[model samples]
Each structure stands twice: as C-alpha cells, then as structure tokens.
Target: MPTEISSPIQGSLVAIVTPMHADGALDLEALKKLIDWHVVSGTAAIVIVGTTGESPTVDVDEHALLIKTTVEHAAGRIKVIAGTGANSTKEAISLAAYAKSVGADASLSVVPYYNKPTQEGLYQHFRAIAEAVDLPVILYNVPGRTVADMATATTLRLAEVPGIVGIKDATGDVARGSDLIRRLRLLEKGSGKRFGIYSGNDDSALALMAMGSDGVISVTANVAPKLMADMCRLALAGDFAGARAVNDTLMPLHFDLFVEANPIPAKWVLARMGRCNAKTRLPMTPLSARFEPVLEAAMRHAALL
Candidate 1:
C-alpha cells in the first residue's frame, strides 16, 4: 500500500473522450492534444478510458495504451487517473497493475456492471484491486449503468483498505452522498485514513461539494473544463455563491448534454465545438440533428460556443 499518494485530487477532473481517426483507429495526435488542452484549461485531473471515454468498446491493449499515452502527454502537469475497472477481478487487477506500471496517479474502479454483486462481494472486489495495485483506488458506484449500488457502509469498509483512498459517488442521491461524506469524516477521525469523496454526478457536484465532498469526476468537463473547474474551485473554497453563479450558467449545458445517453450528447457538443470527431463506438450514435439546435443554443447561452 502506498501511503505516498498525495492528498486526493481536488476540483474538476475530466473523464476525457478517446479521440479516434475517421478510419476508426486511435488518434494518438488528437489524444495528446486533448490531454494538453485539459492541462491548459485547469482540469485538476484527467481520467482516461472511463465511461465517458467509451471504455467498454476498447480492448485491453488499447485501454493500457490510452492510459500510457495520457500519462506521457500530461507529463506530471496534471494528474491522470485511469479507468482500470472490469467485471472480472483478474482483469481489473491486471488493468490496475498496468496503470501503476505506466505511472498513472490513481485508478477508478467502477462497480461491476451487469453482474449486480452483493455488498460483501462489492467490498471483496474493490479490496482485491486495491491490494493488487500499489496505487490509490477510487471506487466508482454508478448505479445508473452498473444496476447495483455499493452502499456507504461497503465504501466505508473499503476505506480501511490501505490502497482504497476515495470514491466517485454517481448515485446522484445528494442525501446519500452527504451521508457517505459524514460517515467517512467520522471514520477518519480515529483511523488517520483519509478517504476522499468525489461526486460522479455533474448535476449534484455543487451540492455534494457543499456537503464536504472533495470534488467531481465530471463528464461535462470534457468540453467545459474551465467553467467546471471554476465551479469546483469556488465550492471547495467555501464560496458557494460564486460556485452557484458558475453552476447556474452551466446548468442548461449540463441538462441538455444528457438529452440522449452520455457520450452521444457529449460527443455531439464536442463535434460542434470542433474538438473531437464526434465518432463513438457502436451501440452509441451521434446526437440527433433535431437536438442539435437545442444543444447549440444551450452551448451559446453557456458561452461555450
């Protein structure tokens, strides 16, 4: 277990999309440019190959390359947290170990989707990954996709694991997120084990930060990194009024970005901005043109255009 992992990252961390060429090949040049853009735009961290990055569509070698490329391009300018999770424990461990090998700052292990593991099983799953890798592990509990939730108690237990250092609470239930924050604070009072709590829900990030969450692992940040980072900066600094102002401006963009499924709207927004190609792996598609004007107007209003 590496106690040397710095105080968990704060402010907005973007789950960046993996850029691909028109031929469907990994666009390494575009990928490096995106990584550089995040660093320049004040993104606190960059999570490569996460859900927003279309992790499910990528094979293991591509996954490892994404992490390695991101870390290389970031060049210690920004923290790189790799999405090294899978339903299989062995595969997850291998990915996590690869993340460590490639010098990633941390690993985001999302809950096993489609499998619906019990609380005990969830704990064991995360604990095994933490023990297997020497890097800090942030549990990702997105019930929306996983179809299963890792309870606060389970997260608290995993907090005891030497390498399990934080969680990305995407359940979107602010009360539950607040409860988990309170619980982690109480547990840390005695153990000296600090477990960071980051909201995976872009909508509830401000509220969660108000309740003592460290920051957010944001999907919205992929396009609006500066605004998202500024919001988190304000909230973390106890400037709720300032944060709310930024959040309010971003509200329309946030809501509309999910007009379809995640990456669809997101990639569409990026395409409109000319940032990425807007190409997503199958089972996902481009945002409908009917919604284009709607998102474009929202982006204009948000001043992201």
Candidate 2:
C-alpha cells in the first residue's frame, strides 16, 4: 500500500491551468515555468489537470503526461495533487493509478460528471477508487459542473474510509460547508482521524476558511498566487481581520475569473501577464473580447495588472 498522506493538507492549493500554445498543443516548457513560479510565490500545493486545467478536453495519455510532468517538475519543492477524475470509475482508477506511479502526493477525484450517480452510487464510486489504489484521495464535490452532488452525510460516511483524506466542497454554500466542518469535527473527536474540508469556490473561500475550513482549492490562485497564499495563511492562522483585508483585494478576481467558463478568463489573464499563452482546447474557447475590460479592471483591482 502507498504510505498514508500526511494530515492537514491546507492553504492556497491553486487549481492550476494547463498551459497550451496558440495551436492548442500542450506547452510543457510553460508548465515547468508555472510550477517554479508557484513554488516561489508561496502556493501551498499544485492541483494539475482539474476543471480549471481543462481536464475533460485532455485525453488519457495527455492526462497522465501532465500529472507525470508536474510531479517531476515540482521535484519535491511543492505538493502536486493530480486531477485524476473521470465520469467513468474504471477510467478514474486507471488515471489515479498512473498518478501513483508517477509519484503525485495525492489525487483529487471529482464527483462523477454526466451520469448523475445516486448518493450510494457516489459512495461506492469513490470507495472503489480508494480501495483499488493505494493513492490518497481527496473527494471533489462541485455539483455546479458535475451535476451529482455529494451530501454532507455521504461525505461523513466516506471519512471513515482509509486513504480518503479530505474533500473540496465547491457548492459555494457556506452554511453547508460550515455544517460539514462541524460534523467532521465531531467525527474526529470520536474516531481520532482527521478529515480536511477545503473550499473549491474562490469567491467564498475567505468565509469558508473563517468558518473553520482547512483552506481553498482556488481558481484565483492561478493568477494571484502570492496574494492568495497570504490570504489563506492569514485565514488559517485565525486572523480573519488580516485575511479579510487581503481577501477584499482579491474579491474582484475571485468573481471575474469565472466570468466565462472557468479557465477561459484565467488563461487570458495569464497571457496578459506574460505567464502563458491564452489558448484552450475546443468546447472551451479563448476568453470573449467583450469580457476583457471587465477582467482587466478586476486584475487592476487586485494589483495583478
């Protein structure tokens, strides 16, 4: 079995974008540069090939290569959480196993998309993956995209599963997130095992963390890494006032990055900053020109411009 993941994986884990050239080819060189930048910029972890990274568009081989390349490139300087999710269970297992082979620290397995599995189905789906591989798994529940939402009870149930370490709750419902945290704390008191709850929605991250979430799986962190990192640090350290000050600066970016579908705006901003090309695969397009001024103003508000 793979070694157990360490407790308390927390802070600004950037749901990083996969850099692509104008022709939509994977930009491996640019990826390496981004990893180095994250390390220096104090990003707590790198979540590669996630929704923000356009996971659906990449083929299986491309997915494996991205995970492998990121783990290799990070080179122990940062933790790489490979986005090894798939709507298919077997496929998710295969990708997760590949992530394990390539030495990723953990796997962020999203709730199955499109199929709309029942809660029991969701439980078995995630459990099967955890049982099938030794890799530590973090459950991602973003019903907005996945359609199938995992309930807090189901999440608590999965907390009992060994190797299922934490969850990224993207429902953007703070009441739900805070309630889950309360229940998880109760469970920890009884079972002596820790279960981390991370906010997957950037706009509500500060509130969630302040309400006792572990940290954020942030989309905004892709562009504003240092500021995001600092905010998360302050939030986790229980300095909500300081964290709020930083978060206030980032609030505009938190909302605008999702002005289009996830990565479109994120990639555009990265290109503007000269970090990477703004190209994305089909079904996902470049940011619409109409939204540029809106995004640019947000960037300026965040001092990223």
For all candidates, the clash counts are 0, 0
C-alpha lDDT of residue 276 in model 2: 98
Q: Clashing residue pairs in candidate 2, if any?
A: none
Q: What is the C-alpha lDDT of each candidate?
A: 0.89, 0.92
* Model 2 lDDT tens row, 99-196: 99999999999999999999999999999999999999999999999899999999999998988999999998988988998999899899888887
Candidate 1 ranges with C-alpha deviation above 4 Å = 4-6
Winning candidate number (lDDT) = 2
Give residue 181's error in model 1 in angstroms.
0.7
- Name the top TM-score candidate: 2
Q: TM-score per candidate, in order? A: 0.98, 0.98
TM-score of 2: 0.98
Question: Where is model 1 poorest over a 10-residue stretch in terms of lDDT?
Answer: 1-10
| Candidate 1 local lDDT, 19-92, one digit each (tens) | 87766678878788878888888999999999998999888889989999999988999999999999999999
